[model samples]
Target: MYDIVIVGAGPAGATLARLIGSKYKVLLIDKRDMENENPKKIKNKCCGGLLAPDAQKMIAQLGLGIPKDILVNPQLFAVRTLDLNNNLERLYQRFYFNMDRDKFDQWLISIIPNEVDKRLNAYFKSFTEISGGYEISYIYNGQEILAKTKIIVGADGASSKIRKLIAEDISSPEKYISIQEWYECTEYTPYFTAIFDEEISDFYSWVIPKDNYLLLGSALRPREDTWNKYNLLKAKLIKLGFTFENKFKTEGAYINRPKRGSQLYGGKDNIALVGEAAGAISPSSAEGISYALKSSLYLAQSLEEGIDGFLDRYNQRIKGIRLNLLIKNLKSPAMYNPFLRQLAMKSGLQSIR
Candidate 1:
């Protein structure tokens, strides 16, 4: 029996494992094959792959240095905000490190202790409450395997199956379908562009320049016409002189859009949650790496120190993060509200000349 079963190997799971893997018998699991020794298919998040300033701060606090290989071309220095409805464009000074998202995840997994058992291509199936702990079942190579663990941690992303199977009350966040596409770049697009079109998405859409390709992504409401909205966004961006030579690959996933602090929870009882699974992502910007790292770190401190049963301590420690998310929600109207955003753009409050 393992002490803990982490159902994801993302930043949250990897960090938690790195911190407490040596202390406990940890079994880290992920649907993606992130391990180094075995060669298998690769998978990762559908993210913009840009680390915001807050993420940089978390990395600094963790004393983690990003490797050169993880670095991608065209490090972003500014954000180009486009209001398609108002036909207004503004540039704001911002610092973001463009990196390879998959490679970054692999690095996080690589730091995990060797003692920890990692299984890949294993899709979580179900779980049952046993006498002492829980029996977790997952599909490996099309076969089901069972393992017992004292505690289960849901470090999975917005669409965490672990969270769904959780016994305790979980604050549910609004889910959105995020679609990202990589296009072969005809010319260099330097700025990280933020597109706002009510016709496309009430949340938002983005364009980031990766190595030899431009990654265009959107957070749209889940519906039958979701692709229609995405297509609308593309048509609007094209009108703004954006060119796409060819589409290379498209990736999509379910992302959480937490509107209230009450939507955030650190889990309860034997089941614990960290990262986006716990509604730790930003409500305004949708940046998750910083919150993911912070949540996992707090959970680690609670587990590693054996401070009052991990769950209670973990919940208490994450209040600041939840509050931070609420504050971002407060700031959302200024960015998302079309009239307010238009006024702000016209005023050129923080926009670069």
Candidate 2:
């Protein structure tokens, strides 16, 4: 039996595996064949692919530096905040990194020790309680596979199967269907921009420029009107002097935004949940990489203490990070409220001159 089984190989799962894979008999499972599978055919993450300051701090705490190859062209210096409702625009200084999100995830997976059993193109189904641990069942290569693990970790994203088994007592945070589209460009856009239009979404939308493409993405409520709002956003940006060229790719994914600390579901029994699986994401900004990295680090430290009573330790350690996420919820209203956002932009508070 393996000592631990980690579900999902995104930032949280990959980081967790990298940290404790050497110490434990670990099985790392991921649905995507990131290495072999053609990215165009698969549903990739719908992210702006920009690393925020909080994520940078977590990377530093882990004593690791991002490789230069993972970075994208035109390193950003400022964010142009657009108030579509009031015709106000302001530039805010930024230290965020523009990188290839897929490559970054692959790099994290690459660092994992060879001792860990890395399983790709594996779809997790369910788990059941057993004598010493849990019996995990998954579908891999057109066959149902079963395994035993003393401890299980759900590092999956917002719609986590493992979390469903454990966190029934807590309701999931607000769920938003994030949609992003890539457009080919003749020239590179110089700055990253954030657009606020309550008519489009209550959360936010972003325009980030990569090498020869521009990424436009938004977090919107999942409803029949979702695409209508997205199309409207594109139309709005066109009026704001942003040129749209031939469309290349589009991606959609589920992202959970928690408004309170109580919404974060850690885990129970020998199972532990980390990253967006536990709702450890920002309600204000919908930023998750920082929380994903921090939660995995906290889980790794807890596992280091010993598998016995590890759940309590993991949950206890997660409290601090959850508290921080809760605080972000407090700040969300100022940005989401159109009147307040216009006031802040007009006052030029914290906006770089």
Candidate 3:
């Protein structure tokens, strides 16, 4: 039996595997094939692919260099915040990396140590507790497969299957569907754009420019009027000088916000939920990569202290990070009001200086 079985080979699972795979028998499973070179066949992460400064630091600490092929743009130097209601715009200087989400995920998977049992194209089915461990049922190559592990790390995304099995007592957080569309760009901008308009979306919208393409997306509350709102956003962008072809494709995924007191651990069980599965996403910016990597690091450190107090330690660390980020996002509500947004923007600029 393996020491740990990590589900979903995204940032969290892959980083965890890299950290402890040498010391423990680890099995990293992902539904996507890491060997696949075709971009069209890869899974879409539905991300704007902007890596905040915090995430860049984490990667630097891990001693990993970003592959050139994975990065779509060199670096974003500024952010353009647009107040749609007031027809005002403000620019803030910041440094962030813009990448292709699919390739970035693949790069993370590629760094996992060879000793870690990396299984791609393996679809996780279920988990059942057994003697001294859990039996992980999965489908591989049109056949059923089973693996035994002492601990289960649910590093899956927001809609985690492993979380459904373990976090039965935990209430789910507020969820929104993120819809994104990539378009061929006629002009390039050095700034990433964020737009706020309560009439279009209660959450937020972004326009991120890459090498030759621009990705526009918004997190929208699930409602019957979602399509209407999306169309309205499209029209608003058009008015702001964005053009899209009639035949572009769209991608979507679910993003979960962290609840105030949600459980990060599965009640003293051997299951540890990390990343978006445990609501480690930022409520303000909707950024998740940094949390995914940081939370997994915390989990690895906790597991290093043996199994007895690992769950408690992991929960404490994860919860501390979430609460801090939430508190930092306390200013999010002000973005809905034009006057408050302007004031907040000014305050933010002053603080940065």
Best by TM-score: 2
Q: What digit string (tens of lDDT, one per residue) describes model 2 on residues 1-353?
A: 99999999999999999999989999999998866647664446678889999999999999889999999987998999998888899999887899999888878988889999988889999999999999999999899999999999999899999988888877888899999999998676778999998899888899999988999999999985999999999998898678878999888899999977888888888998999999998888888999999999999999898999888988889989878987887888789888888888899988888
Local accuracy of candidate 3 as per-residue lDDT tens digits, 1-353: 99999999989899999999988999998998866888777767789898899899989888888988888764788888887877767887888888887888888877778899988888999988999989999888899999999999998888998888877778876789998988877686788988898888767899888777788888898874887898899898898887876436798999986546453443348888888888778777888898889988998899888877788888777767857666746756676667888777766653323
What is every candidate's alpha-carbon RMSD to the true fold? 1.6, 1.3, 2.2
Q: How close to the true structure is residue 253 of candidate 2, measured as C-alpha lDDT?
A: 94
Instruction: Sort by TM-score, best first.
Output: 2, 1, 3
Number of the candidate with higher TM-score, 1 or 3:
1
Candidate 1 per-residue lDDT over residues 1-353, each given as its tens digit = 99899999899999999988999999988999776445336875789999999999999999999998999989989999999879999999999999999889999988889999999768888889999889999988888999999899999899888888773465699899999999998578789999998888889999999989988899999985999989888887887788866899899999999998888977767889999999899989889999999999999898876635889888889999978987999999998999998898999998899
lDDT of 2: 0.90
Q: Which whole-number lDDT from 0 to 100 does residue 7 have in model 1?
A: 91
How well does candidate 1 score on lDDT at residue 257? 90
Off by over 4 Å in 3: 259-268, 337-339, 345-353
Backbone atom clashes (below 3 Å) for every candidate: 0, 0, 0
TM-score of each: 0.96, 0.97, 0.93
Best by lDDT: 2
- What TM-score does model 3 achieve against the real structure? 0.93
Q: Which lDDT values do the candidates have, in the order given?
A: 0.89, 0.90, 0.82
